[model samples]
Target: MAAPGTLRRFLATAWLITRKDITVEWRSREIIYTTVFFAASCILVFAFGFVKDGRPIDDVASAILWIAIAFSGTLALGRTFERERYNETLQALMLAPADRPAIYAGKLAGILLLMLAVEAVLVPLVALLFQAPLFRQPVLLVALLGSGTLGYAAVGTLFAAMLVRARSRDVLLPVLLYPITIPVIIAGVRGTAAAMAPDGGEMARAWVSMLVFFDVVFLTLSLWTFEAVMTE
Candidate 1:
């Protein structure tokens, strides 16, 4: 067990790092606005292209929703550490006198917060534009969002560290991330679709379980591997 002081220090460090991320975002607001705009544009394009046949927009709403989210999320995750790389602050953070996991946890928390905020905006916009029944089942929607976003963040955090050093970092993140995140996306979409249905209890439960399992597995893997990835 950690000593009281150790735990306190860890919490303080995590809080400080989280605050730094929020402060940076508050100053620019570029990432959030860009992500929201891209997401909305993607949904609008889908609405125009796919709804021409007079089909109910909800018919393909799930696919469109996830595609927008996945793409926007990739954009945000790629940029998460870009400022640090440009400014050389990541090395400073690594050299700080704190446990590595605290850094990782802080970053994870920040990314998760950003992701949830993006989704909060995107979900309603997509639903409104596509006429999908998004709020019909708030509980399942919450579960799907929670599990899927965590899984995306888990892999994304590590890749953000890795790609920060690469030449094609922006392009590389999605190429690396998409293959790994398919399972989570699949589970999320299925769970969300079922949750939107009146008789979707069992399906929703199963997909949520799969999502939870995926979250636990990838989260552990990301935490364990983050130190090595960051160092390399």
Candidate 2:
């Protein structure tokens, strides 16, 4: 690979960080098992309310899906940075020569990857359990999940890093995170609902467009503030 421009270098650094996190998780199987289990268990618990005598109540699948994503995502984000905090590497990472935003991007990417893995299990289980035709509009569904998760991960990555130095980080993460990400969770739920709607995914396109726009805005704000946040 040629080291041509700043973009290449940034991406290279981000990938290295992502690979490191993933490699560690692969060896330990901690994040994956924990996230997936939490997400799955969330779905099963909701099964009681959503599933009727034999079928799921109308429009429940979308709610269940997003709830699982949000809850499990929080778990992944907290633990992802906790490793850095516990290993005493976060300070060194902050002091590294790389752009702080790039480091943030790398951590964000790793969390998103872990969440996606959890979603892979969650989505299929949702379809099977609730009989939600989630695959009806695969492309649209993917867009909603991708953009929504991006928005969620963008904010989460920042907060988890900031709270890495705090004593009550685990307690503080969801408190700080949920209020900002409600829009993301709502967009994801709405778009996903539209995608599986019998109306032929008409409104899903609009929601997808809006969610993508939100992703851009959230990521911009998060990246811009990352350096300042980490400095303290």
Best by TM-score: 2
Give the Cα error of residue 41 in candidate 2, in Å.
0.7
Q: What is the lDDT of candidate 2?
A: 0.89
For all predictions, the C-alpha RMSD in Å is: 1.7, 2.1
Best by lDDT: 2
- Give per-residue CA lDDT, model 2, range 1-232, as digits (tens): 5356888878888888889888999999998999898899899989987788878898899989998999999999998898998878989888789978888889889899888888889999999999999999999988889889989999999999999989999999999999989988888888899899889577999888888888899999999999998886
What residue pairs are clashing in model 2?
Answer: none
For residue 89, give model 2's deviation from the true position in Å: 0.9
Instruction: Give the alpha carbon lDDT tens digit for every residue of 56-140 in model 1.
Output: 5554777778888889888787777887898889889999988877887788788888889988988887787777887888988
lDDT values for all models: 0.85, 0.89
151: Cα error in model 2, Å: 0.7
TM-scores for every predicted model? 0.93, 0.96
